[model samples]
Target chain A: MSSILKITDLHIAVDGKPILKGVNLEVKQGEIHALMGPNGSGKSTLAYALAGHPKYEITGGDIEIDGASLNELDANERARLGMFLAFQYPVTIPGVRVADFLRHAVTNRRDPDRKEGENLMPMREFRQELRGRMNELGMDPEFARRYLNDGFSGGEKKRMEILQMAMLKPKFAILDETDSGLDSDAVKVVSEGLSSLAGPETGVLIITHHERLLEFNRPQFTHVMLAGRIVETGDASLAHELHANGYTTVRERHPAEAAEEQAEREETLATV
Target chain B: MSTVTVNSAPSLPSGFTSDDFEVFLQSRVEPVWVTQRRRVAFELFQAKSAEELDPEEWKRIPARAFRPEKFSLTGKAAIGFDTAQLPLMQNRAEFEGAVVHVDGSATESRLTEQLAAKGVIFGDLATVLCQQADLLEPHFATKAVLPDTDRFAAWHGAFWTGGTVLFVPKGVQVDAPLYSLVALAQDGVADFSHTLVILEDGAEATLLEETASGSPDIAGLHVGAVELLVGKEARLRYVQLQNWNQKSWHFAHQCGRVEGNGSLQWTVGGLGSKLAHIHQDVHLDGRGAEAQVNGVTFAKDRQCLSYYTQQTHNAPDTRSDLLYKDVLTDESRVIWRGMIKVEPEAQKTDGYQRNDSLLLSPTSRCDAIPGLEIEADDVRCTHGATAGRVDVDQIFYAMCRGLTEHEAMHIIVQGFLQTVTDRIPVELVRETLDKAVEVKLGIGE
Candidate 1:
């Protein structure tokens, strides 16, 4: 049976303020989902909550894989359960090489019970596999030796996130704005990279505003978020309509949620 | 356990009294000149010990509990004590020569025949001093690490014991590195080991040395000195790994002088010791001379490690670059006071010094002070120091990729030290330092 990631009535808050209010969604292996929303719509909050970020308080939620709940697990435990998050703003870990970081991640993902300092994958085999993956992603093999995300360009950082997803091969991968702040060519690269990496056994959730990303990896299901909640669920054509048009039509159809989003914007603006 | 006698009673003053010095001198068989130098140093030690230590250097370092009377110099080396088990760079790479000293006595010293044919001298300091007195007399104490600098220097100068010495003849390049191990195995043993390396004009060599205790429970003391003299147009790479047990007290004055067109690369790894304070100096003494110094220190538990470093530019066109990285955890503390000085005649000199520290726990503390003094108007000098905790975001990012919290922290701490590690060119030294870091983090084999 295909592994299932079930999210039921998920409520998440940041610093005591509700950002994701009663979000319910279910994604299974091999399915591609697109999450679309305006700014402050809690799109990223859901992504962080699913990855078990400590800062994202799960006020009321049940996130599970197969049958085991992940609400109590930390980010690392969730990662070991085949959940991966491609951060929109990838962190720079100075002095840590890309190859070394990926090797550690890959080893842990393969053997979840392995303790720290235990044997990692053999260097010969790991190097071969990493080299092959980098070749497939069109990344310079020299990048393997460079420090992770240190002194990298925006496009390079995004591509690195994709590269990590490829290496991890998570059962459910969430790309949180992995294609934002990139040129069209870079977007095409990331889009095509995600398309190639998300295979039959890998479930992908693309969190992006760029049409180029959805143009390549056409999602089977599209979820539109508003006011910290999933206000609408639709198909690929709805994504196309929302892309060609904008959230204005969706807001017109859902006035109550739109008013709540307006109220959130006013409160944020007042504080700023 | 030893009982402490009250001061009211006329107890032979706790540590290194005149009686102890006289007896120590009687045990050594050396030339008249060496004895004369020791006597002078002994007088200086007496005078300096009476005076207060420099408040500027000792104020931050706590030494109230350190009782010198508790430790005494051992007259004999421990039998069957294995220096190989201390482990830093031993058996990690091929070396042209190797030396082992335990309890301030030479155990094993050897130099490859091929290198010895090239007039390269590698042996214990005691044996080398007796055999090659004429060749070593000029550079031994006359240059770098003078005895009168401080009480510890004077004490070490007077009671200096067996250590490793490397001498490369002018223009000969000893490609492979050399290894030295100074160890202590018995409780209350004082190992005053000295390391001296000399490279003549256009000569090149590399030496790696480490200090260790036979076991963790042994309480020992090390009052040591290191002097490196690079002759004109020569090059030398020296690494000293200080990995004593937590019950050990280490005090050392290390200095390096680079002559005209010569270069010296010095790397220091401070891993173990209850409390250690190292005074390190690098002198660019001639035109076009250069020195690159790198330090990696990890302090944990209640340990306190301090470094007072100086880089002096004395000639025109000289260059010196120094970088020190430290990691602290538990209630441990690390202090770094660095200074760069440029003499008036050292015009067009380039000097750079920086220290970065990573604090792993809330209770851990780090104090970094960087200063510069310039007498030359046409020189470029810059220094900086930064102390910060490991970024929680970086930890989260690593955890999101599947590393446990401890593993993530270990990796982050290693990354923090990678900047200095990159400056070192020796693969064996780098790997050994990495492995040592793993051991300190309580992980790895």
Candidate 2:
């Protein structure tokens, strides 16, 4: 199987306003790609669009997973197609317990082609798998008894997302700002956890605004997005360059794109 | 829209005329005062029909849609129901006292020797009326709830054949909880039962009353009443579980009065009935009294459940808190109209009530109206109502793990209703409610 995600001339919009315009990318299994950008640079947009978020409209271009189109699929369908997007802000469901929710998710995702009501993991095995993964992530044993994401701290929510990643083990995983709300020590823990969870057959696209996360989970390629477009692409050294000299050189390198973004912002402010 | 049939008045049930009432009256033996009250109630019931005046909000309830003529009053005699065969009430050795009533007749009555020594009265109403008429008369259908309150009360007053009378004497604290099972087994019969609980000064006890039917889809009618009298400094935990069959239409009027420094904890579970309408009220009548009311209603498959609750703070320095949660699925509908009223003299009172509705199906509808009427100055009163569908993302999140839609729904619903079930302090009662939830969801398989 060709475990490659090919994105060509992708034009995406939010509520009819263009966000990711003519974006192009290619991701293959057994590789890690880091997506870094300023605020509103459409980094998260690419992740959400690939995850089939209804609000992010794909106006042009196509996303192909091993030559299969995912433009018309729903989030769940995309997930079944070996694509996963960890939410930047996980929604809290008051009544549902964490352990039970994950069991059902794991049950359905393991056999992607299994028919409904077939191949559900028995309770004993499911509980053991859940506890094993939870312990690996250093999550409290009682965490499974708590309601999903209800009253959880910021770092806890981030760790929960990573724990889910460890359990689901999708072919392609997109971690959106997984270290946003975490302290340095917590970020190191999450990065290490993600490293151990992924393998030769797994592909990861880490979206972030800081290079701190990239220190632990080294990405093979680093891409910088500005105003809905990826302007520069380089090896891991590019991230070190950005961390040292900052994005000043990228802005200077892509003056045309920068000018266009300034004009768009002015027009939006005028309309408002 | 114009294809609907409109009836201005609902007719009385077939074969239930004045002559039938006379026959029913003559068939039973009772005291003169009881007979007089029955005659008065029957007269009032005859003079009025259910359509004349409604609670306005009760329009959501399907009680009026039922034709009284469809059910037969002359059902198999109440004795035809065998309580001993009930699987629900079979393994209850932990209960201090156990009384089982089948179709308005006591089939089993037993009490621990220690409770009997303490003068704890746990028996059928008919037996109480004969054995302790002096203590029973002063509280039955007199103060906690009047016989002339409504049609259901009047009907119960005219024909209350089988019920429970539990009396915990002054300062007597029964260590083990008492249990009562009111099971409707026969077809086309009306169950007019009453539970009158009287707690003397400084007494404390726990009581669980379960309403269930051994058969499913058996046409049944239940017009019942429950009156709890918590005397000064007394404490009582009252748990009522209503799990009738799908073919049953039930109506109940339940009220409790708390005297000075008394405390009342009332937990209710409504998981059955094709159509049910109930009015539950609590009055903090004496100073320093406190009351907490909690209930869970699980409705499924074209069922209509309605509950009208009121917490009236009538005395100073009293507190009342109420929380009721409902989970509805299929084409089921639920209505909750709750009010917290603080009187002028009830200063320094704190009253709170909240009703939340969880809709499992798109077609299920819920109406939760919460209100507060306060005439007192120094008081804290709050009420809230929420009606919402189960969060879709929650379902999707669960499905992503490996669960089918049905399995995900079961988990979400059980978690949603745990808010009220957890309030049931008694372990056994909570277990029974848990089993009911499992049965309703069809998940145990």
Q: Can you give the DockQ of every candidate in the order shown?
A: 0.77, 0.30
Model 2 Cα lDDT, one tens digit per residue, A76-155: 66776678777788878776788877766776677666654455678899889889998888889899988889999888
Task: Please give, for residues B196-309, the per-residue lDDT of candidate 1 as tens digits.
Answer: 999999999999999988999999999999999999999999999999999999999999999999999999999999999999999999999999999999999999999999
Residue B7, candidate 1: how far off, in angstroms? 17
Instruction: Identify the runs in model 1 with alpha carbons over 4 angstroms from their true place.
Output: A248-272, B1-13
The runs of at least 3 residues in candidate 2 whose Cα sits more than 4 Å from the true structure, single-residue gaps closed, are A1-31, A36-84, A97-146, A166-172, A181-189, A192-203, A223-234, A238-272, B1-12, B55-57, B60-62, B74-94, B438-445
Top-lDDT candidate index = 1
The CAPRI class of candidate 2 is acceptable
Question: TM-score for all predictions?
Answer: 0.95, 0.81
- Cα displacement (angstroms), candidate 1, residue A10, comes to 1.7
lDDT of 1: 0.90
True contacts kept of each: 0.85, 0.40
- lDDT for each residue of candidate 2 in B67-148, tens digit (9 for 90 to 100): 6555554423465555655545346456878887777777778888889899889988877787787778888899877778
